[model samples]
Target: MERSLAALLVCVFGVTTGEFVLAGILPAVAGDLEVSIPAAGLLVTAYALGMIVGGPLLTAITAGRPRKPLVVGLLAVAVAGNLLSAVAPGYGVLFAARVVTALVTSTFFANAIVIATSAAPAGKQASTVAKLVFGMNLAMILGAPLGTWIGEAFGWRATFGAITACCAVGLLLVARLVPGDQPVTRSRAFGEFTVFRNQDLVLAIAITAVANIGLLMVFTYLAPLLTGPGAFAAAAVAPMLLVYGVGATIGNLIGGRLADRALLPSQLGALAVLVVLLVALWASPHPVVTGLLVFAAGAVGFSVIPGMQTRVLTTAAAAPTLAIAVNASAYQVAAAFAGWLGGRVIAGPGMTSIYLAAALATVLGIGLSAVALRRDRVRVKQSVLR
Candidate 1:
């Protein structure tokens, strides 16, 4: 990878750490801010909402700008937001700061991925995108745990302060390293929305939304599930999470390779594995079994992500920036839905229900993938007949 792309990867790691650090340090934030845990939890909701609303909108608005400077500006927003988070005196200020940071985070993801793919050598697009996303997976694997430990050792404010410093470094690296490219063409922001007219691209978006909902539904409540029935010691949670993260990283690389060879089959196979693993996790009570299943779940679930991302790029070849931005927004939409639905399921039906619910969502994603595959076959047939 180029030094510039490596910097972008580190930038992604920082942004993703910021996104998930709140989850690991929620109790500290709640206590420090004098809010209920549930209320403090709304910070996550606020961030996801911002991503859902801001990603496409901001990407469309900046569609014509030079990507390098745009990325630097977005990273500056992240730095400011995190700095505000580090010193916020009330829940409302922190909430607003998180929203602002999330807007920058999502828009940055859209722009960064476009840059990664654009800068990649011929026939290696999926692999480059996977490397970029691997940074996010690394955050889940290590950064969140470290941030949480810092919060416990010092304070939640300290965690945000560290994140702010990280963002500042990322900003400098992006500004100095990423190449500046002039606009190829210019159009109204509304014109970007026209990519939605493509049914294949829309299906790709649905796959992202549904698959992520399923993935996060289980992940958002994973701690309780691990300790509740599995009877694992509290100390074991972090290690188990690491195992899952490792699996996720492996799956991400595998998925990229598979997508290059066989996109449709790779996605189908991954979702199928995910559905089976979710069911297995629900039934297994042993800690070892649970840990193995958790790893497999992460592996299989994430294995399809690159395929879904690349699908949007291929299908919306003419408007990949908007399509990919919409794709990122779809993930945020799924996250919001997963958080709400998982909460309801945990409250009403109990914790195990979260996995079952996620399984159902994955099943839907599988159905959608099947439909997309069928459509591809028919189009191929028509081409041959013509």
Candidate 2:
């Protein structure tokens, strides 16, 4: 990998690690801060809220800036946030620090994606984007776990301190290696909102929001699903989740390859496969079979992401950062909705039905994706006639 891309990948990994590492250390945080676990859990909600609210606004606020400087600056903000988190004197301050960290998270990620994909070799955008996405996959697999370990071994504050150090390394690399030649002199501050008027762009964003809801919901509840319906030992949850992460990593790479060949068709096919796989998880009669199903679900479920993200970037290439930021925000919104919907499903139907509920959500995503593609085709034919 190019050093510049590597730096950006590290930034992606560090920033994402900041987003998720809270899960592993919430108990430590709550106990130290003298707050309840649920209160510390609100730290997660606050970060998500910040991302959903902050990404587009910040992206728009900084439209047309030089990409290199913007991303580096955002990483600097991330460093400050995490440092504040490490030294926060009380829960209120730590909560603020988390929101501050999250506010820059998605926007920084969007800019990095734009930078990386802009520098990609021709016809390799999806594959390149996947490389950046791979950083997030590693965050789930490695960064979060490592940070959790640091928290366990030292203290929760040490986890944030470690994240801060990682972001600082990414910042130094980005400053030294990533090229700053790209500039968006044409991007209007608020005029980028006009991108929203594009039907395909709208659909691309919708596909992201709708399709991933299923997998996110199911994954959110996977531990329970494993120990409950699958009748696995409680100790087995982490290993099974590891199985899913391995599958996700492979799926991300495969999705990148498929998307480079054919973006929408591959996305559609992947979504179909995801729906089938989610539904398929319903029939796991043995532990080994259940593990395999979890892996398949992870693989097929994540295979759609690269295409989805790439479509938004391509559709809004004139000014892709804000669009990408909006797309990120949409995914956050989907995650929140998935949490709510999964809760309802569990309360009403039961834990086993969560899989079916997730499958149904993706089926809705399929419908939206089909509509978006059809609209794009019609627009193309009309313009060709014109």
lDDT of 1 at 361: 94
Give one digit per residue, the lDDT tens place, for model 2 in 1-386: 38988999898999899998999899999999999999999999999999999999999889988888898899999999999999999999999999999999988989988888888898899988888998999998889889999999999999999999999999999999998797565666787888899877888998999999999999899999999999999999878888898899899989998999988888888889888888888876788888998999898888888888999998997669999999999999999999999999999989999999998999999999888778878888999999
What are the Cα lDDT values of the candidates? 0.86, 0.90
> Which portions of model 1 miss their true places by more than 4 Å?
182-184, 347-349
Q: Deviation in angstroms for 322 in model 1? A: 2.1
Model 2 residue runs over 4 Å out of place are 379-386
**lDDT of candidate 2 vs native?**
0.90
lDDT of 1 by residue, 304-380 (tens): 88888888888987678778888988988887788889999989998888888999999999999999999999999
Error (Å) of candidate 2 at residue 337 is: 0.4
Worst 10 contiguous positions by lDDT, candidate 1: 181-190
